[model samples]
Target: MSTVFWAIVVLGALIFVHELGHFLVARMMGVRVLVFSLGFGPRIAGWSRGAGETEYRLSLIPLGGYVKMLGENEEEDEEKDQSGHPVVVADAPDSFANQGVWSRIAIVFAGPAFNFLFALMVLVMAFMLGVGELLPVVGSVSRGMPAEQAGLRVGDRVVAINEQPVTRWEVLSQTIKRSEGVPLRFTVERPEGPILLTIQPRVQEMTNIFGETVRTWLVGIGPGSGTEFVTYGFFSALVKGVEHAWRMTDMIVTGVWKIITRSIPADQIGGPLMIAEMAGKTAEQGASSMLFFMALISINLGILNLLPIPVLDGGHLLFFLIEAVKGSPLSEQVRLQANRAGMFLLIVLMAWAMKNDLTRIFSDG
Candidate 1:
């Protein structure tokens, strides 16, 4: 029950933040917003404000939300009310369709931008509040592994890898993974003093939580049991937050490229179920953990929406770019077909993710 609740809360807040971007931008650009809805499908409950200018709705479906603007459908000059009465929309001066290509593009791009900004804010807060992280202290080593063969003891603290300083376990793990099978110089601090050890990571196949086998480099050393809470000052936290968000964006882009190039399996993609489980587990860890998780998800959402796929913000921006270059918008028929294709692709992708989620659930059970 708590998982379901948190999932809804997290997803709902993200969606709202995304849609709010479009809503605010549209209004700022003089486009009349007719409805600001929190969800899709039939309206469960709502109230109108601004003298019925905008209808604020909480709909039955919780999966997604949208902001409807005047003349959003280019073919429609007027919108109908609940009574099926034809209501005249605002004039072309204030209609979304009448706006310049750049304005429309800005409105569309704002959604993804807001998601990234929200992630930055959340990360900053998490850093300020102090999040627990694993240090680079080796607690155990496999007897036959590369680390053991290199004479790395259990009490040795890894200070650097390949001349690059690494203070956290994540950095160390990433460094090892990127090394492939090449020998890396490991700078360690032992009880006596500092020592350098050259170790080549062993390439091994490992099954992830989703039961997908992925090949990764391994040194077979684990971090110590306890975690250290790392906190930063205001300016440092802001800088770190921005850096973290950028790193996440880069990682997601690389991951997507790998998937497209068939370097990563498509079945590794996760959906709502995986998010819910992660949310619950993180919430159990405490507020800081949950906030960090939310920041990660927000970054993911921002990057995913920015992909140059039709039916997404990136797709809209692509159209605007073409319009800007060609000095005119694409043909209505072409746009319609592209949107349809995009929607089809999105549905297929969602179905595939759901299948993977279910497969992992039953396999774990």
Candidate 2:
């Protein structure tokens, strides 16, 4: 029950944020919106300020939501009879179809933009609320490892590597991994005084979380149980939040590329069940952890929507780009076929993800 609840809460909130972006931008661009729905399928409940106003709805399906605007469908602007003659309809000034190309692009792009913005906001809050980080203190030096050979002992607190200060374990580990087997100078604080030691990292074969075997440099030192709740002021948090979001975006983009190149297994893709499981686990960890998880998901959602595939915001932007270049919209038949292909691709992808999720569930059981 807890898992299901948190899943719904997180997914629902993100979907609402996405659709709200389109709604606001469409209204601002003078497009008349007909529906603002939180989900798909039949309307569960809804309200409107008055007749012909945009009807806000909670729908039966929770997988996704959408916003409907006047003249949003390009097909509606054109039709043909059995005799193969073009039938044209008058365009409404406030309809989406009648808007300028740039205006339409802005309205379509708003969904992903809002997602990124929401992620930035939550990350700032998460940082302000304090995040737990492991201090760069060595708890144990592996026997026969480079650290042991270099005389790095237990209780040694690393202050710097090659004169560069590292306060957190994550930074320290990444630095070591990227050292490329080069000898590094480490400055550690001892009871007597600070000591400088030179140690060379060794290339070791390791399996990554993706089940791929890869080689990386390692010193074989583990962090101690020294953790601190680090908090930042408002301005500092804002800077950190932006940096974090950028890092996440880069990481996600790289991951997507890897998957496309077959560097990562396709079966790793997951669907709603996987998200629900993760949401439940994070909620149990605490609000800060949950927020962090949400930020990551929000970033993922933003990047995913920006993919230039048909039936997505990115796809619409692609269409607008082609129209701008050609000085006209694509033929209605071509747009319709492209949209159908995109829809088919999405359905297959969804089904594959669902299969993967169920496989993991049953395998775990």
Candidate 3:
């Protein structure tokens, strides 16, 4: 329940900000927005200002919200459809479609931009408070394992993996994971003296929570006092925040590439259920922790929306780029078809995620 509360709050806040970006910009440009809705479906509670706009609020739906401008859709009502053009509505306010191309572009891009800004803010907060970092230490070396066979001891602290100096546990883990089953030389400081150990991990096949089997290398040992915490001030935090954003963006691109390359199975995808579970766990940590998780998720949302698939911001951007090149927007019929195809793909992905979630819950670890 705590998780659900935090998740909803974060989701609602980010979504409200996203829609508000559009609403505020549209209003600033003198666009006559007929409706400004916070959420979709029937209006649960709402009030309309006589001169400004009709704001119809709605019941709680965690999906998303939108701002509707005058004559946004091509199919206008007969009475309202003064001009019978399929693309542009004649009575459309001169703000949205009427403004210069650049202004129009800014409004469309602002929503995602704000999301990234929000994430940066939260990350800055996290870094300022101090992030936990783990040191690389060998706690318990598995018997008959690579480390044991290579004569590594319990108190040996790993100083470097090959030529890579290890400061944090995460760096060590990533280096090892990337190496797969390859043998690597670890320089460790033992009680007696500094020693080098050649450890080769065995690839272990195991089922994930989603029931999908993945091959990962296993070195049987527990990480002992593996991490140390460090805090930063404003300047450092901002730098770290930017660095974190870059790393996450890289990961997202890599994940996408893996999916395209078929290296990552589509069945491993997750949806709302996985998000909720993550939210719950993060909430248990505290507000700051939950906020941190929320920021990361927001970044993912912002980037994912910009992918060049249909019905997404990226899809729209791609079309805009093409329009800029070809001298006009794609025809409505062609755009609509593309949207339908995107929707179909999105639904299938969601269903697969839900299935994976269920499998994980029922399975014994």
Candidate 4:
């Protein structure tokens, strides 16, 4: 099915880009990678490659991939002379753990960086292929809806919300969603002309296509039907692609901030189930649409990985930052203890997200 294919394709590309970051950086840092695998678990097909003892592979599981750099675990390799302390590889140039803090940091951070870049590439490509922004036109207004009550009519161009100019329909939607039930002063351009309206949103339970209910503040307005695929010049695509990535990054940052600040509900969290659902549907639409979603998710992945929580790149980065400030790495004992703490925290977070996802998935039905 197209959905399954797209889901797999997106997940595969994401894992590949992430692993590629680690692999390339390891190579650059002179670390010997034992294996660069496109998937996890038992290898279905693989082979060792030029100048390294590592196997470049396609494994059984497509969910994840890894770059198994030499000296990564420090427990597996045992080439000691007399004592239990292992002998260091003096000959092999590329060893991940052997690299300095900055190099290691760079290697770790590259995964997320590449994801963002990949997303940017997708956005730029879509734009170059002629993706048009949605027009600012009201789709529906409930009889007693805020828009109707405030005299906001159809075919109105929503120029601004709370005096903040919105150039894109996407921006307008996001602004309204995050307004926190405030009485929003919207500058709408009706057929007769522009007018300011104080539109108040009420908390309403809305059912999605999946039959899941979401309690959201509704402003009772929607953008007009359809978007045109507007092709772009190569240069413009590149520039716009980066802008798209930056915008996504910003949105993710703000969303996280809002969650932490209690401006948004904790139930809004999601995990793989939500993502896979989106990916499956998006993939069926075609490359351009899939690409758009991929870029969005890439930015999501990038930002998510950067959260300073343990068992994540951000957690590792946080440790590195502390090491940088302290003029030495955290003690192995401290690192291990912190890691345990992080692992616990990460599990809790995942559990929460998964719980929310499950609740949303089943409750409406």
Candidate 5:
């Protein structure tokens, strides 16, 4: 029950922020927003400021949300009344379709932009409040692995990898992963003083978060069972936050590329159930962990929405770009067909992810 609650809260907050971005930007562009909803399906609870104004709603479904704008679904046409006679509506000037191409582009892009910025802000707060991280000390080396073969021992503190300094296990792991089986020089601090060891990372297949098998470089060294709380000054935290967000973005992009190349299976994709379980587990770990997880999810959502696929923010931007180039929008028929295809693809993907989630649950049970 707690897990369900946290999952809803986390997802709700992210979705609200995303929709808020669109709502604010659309308003700025003089678009009349018809509805601001926090979820899909029938409205469960809501309030309206006045007749014909935006209706704020909390819907039945908590998995997703949307902001509906006036004329968002209508192509520019002669205004008509219920009798099909030409007439002007009171807020026709505020129609989204009547806005300039650039304005529409900005409104569409704002959702993803806000998600990324929210991640940065959350990261900064987490850093300022202090978060625990594993130190760069070797706890154990797996037998017959690259680390052991290179004579790495317990208590040896890794100082650098190939002349690049590493003070944390996270940085060390990233460095190893990027080595791509290349030989590396490890500078370590031992009781006998500093020592250099040459090691070549082994290419190994590992299961990723989505349960998809992916190949990565590994040195078979594990961090000691010790953690250190790290806190940064205000300015340092801000800088670190930006760096953290960028690193996460790069990692996500690389993961997507690997998936596209079929280096990982599509079954690795997960849906809401997986997210709920993760949210629960992270919440149990404490406030810092929960906040960090939120930041990570925000970044993922931002990047996912920016993929150049129809029915997404990136697709809208693509349409705007083409319109700018051709001096007109695509025909209504083409746009409708493209959107239908995109929606179909999305539904199929969601069903597959749900299947994976259910499989995991049943197998675990």
Candidate 6:
């Protein structure tokens, strides 16, 4: 019950943030927003100041949301005035379709842009709240593994790997994973003295966060119980937050590309259930953990929304770009067909993700 609650809260807040971006930008550009909804489907609750005002409301489905602007989906060819010419509903002074191409692009881009901004905000707060990280000391070395075979033992503090100084367990683990079975020189620190050990990593099959079996290089060493809590001041936190967001953005982009290239298995794609589970687990850990998870998910939302598939923010931007190049909006027929195809693709993808989520749940059960 708590899992579902946290998931809804997290997803609902993020969706509101995303749609707020569109609503604010559209209004700024002088477009008339008809509705500002926190979710899709039938409305659950809502209020508006008066007629001609935006209708702000909550909806049935908490999975996603939208902001609907006047003339956003106007059919130019379907309506006609007294004359034989087409009655362009989108050409109204305060309609979204009447805006310049660049304005439209900005309006569309704001949804995803706000998502990244929200992530950065939460990450900065998390950093200010102090983050716990593991040191590079080995807690245990697996028997018959590369670390054990290479004379690496428990309580050994890894100071460097391949001449690169590593102060954190994360860096050490990532370096080893990316070593690709290469021989690594590790400098370890002990109470008596420091010693250098040459170790070779081996490929191992592991289940990743997405429940995909992946082949990765490993030295079979785990981090010790030594943990450090680092807190940043406001300015430092801001800087670190930007850096963290940038790194995560790059990593996510690379991951998406890898999935596209089949470097990552498609079955690894997860849905709302996975998110709910993670949210619950993180919330149980602590506030800071939950904040970090929310930030990560926010960034993921920002990045995924930018993919150039039709029906997404990026798809709208793509259409604007094409309009800018062609000096006109796309033909209604073409746009309609592309949008239908995009919707179909999204439905299929959602089903696939849900299937993966159920499979993981049952397997674990």
Q: Ten-residue segment with the worst summed lDDT in candidate 2?
A: 73-82
Decoy 2 TM-score against native: 0.91
Write the residue-wise lDDT of candidate 2 on 1-365 in tens digits: 99999999899989998999999999999898889999999999999999668999999999999998878875544434469786442266778888999999999999999999999999999999998999999998999999999999999999999999989999899999999999999999999999999999999899876677999999989999999999999999999999999988888888878888999988988899999999999999988888888888888888888888888999999999999999999988888899999999889989999999999999999
lDDT of 6 by residue, 204-277 (tens): 99986544688999989988999999898999999989988898888788788878888888887889999999
Between candidates 2 and 6, which one is better according to lDDT? Answer: 2
Task: Compare the candidates by lDDT and give the number of the best one.
Answer: 2
Q: What is the TM-score of each predicted model, taking all chains together? A: 0.83, 0.91, 0.76, 0.74, 0.84, 0.83
By TM-score, how accurate is candidate 1? 0.83
Which scores higher on TM-score, 4 or 5?
5
RMSD of 4: 6.1
Give the Cα lDDT of each candidate.
0.88, 0.90, 0.73, 0.79, 0.89, 0.90
- The candidate scoring highest on TM-score is 2
Candidate 5: deviation at residue 71, Å?
1.7
Clashing pairs in 1: none
Superposition-based RMSD of candidate 1 using all C-alpha atoms, in angstroms: 4.3
Candidate 1 segments whose C-alpha is farther than 4 A from its true place: 76-91, 142-151, 158-167, 170-220
C-alpha lDDT of residue 218 in model 1: 94
lDDT per residue, candidate 4, 1-365, as tens digits? 65567677788889888888878877887787788899879989988756447788999978668777777666665445456666775323456666778988998898888888788888988887676678666777778888899998777788888889876788887777787898999998877778999998878898743334778888887778855456789998898887777877887888788778877777788876677778888766766778899988888888888998866788889988888889887887887888899889877878998898799879966
Candidates arranged by lDDT, highest first: 2, 6, 5, 1, 4, 3
Q: Candidate 4 at 40: error in angstroms? A: 4.0
Segments of candidate 2 deviating more than 4 angstroms: 74-90, 180-182, 191-193, 213-215
- Total clashes for model 6: 0
Write candidate 1's Cα lDDT for 84-172 as tens digits.
98755534578887888899999999999899999999989989999888999998999899999999988788999988998998898
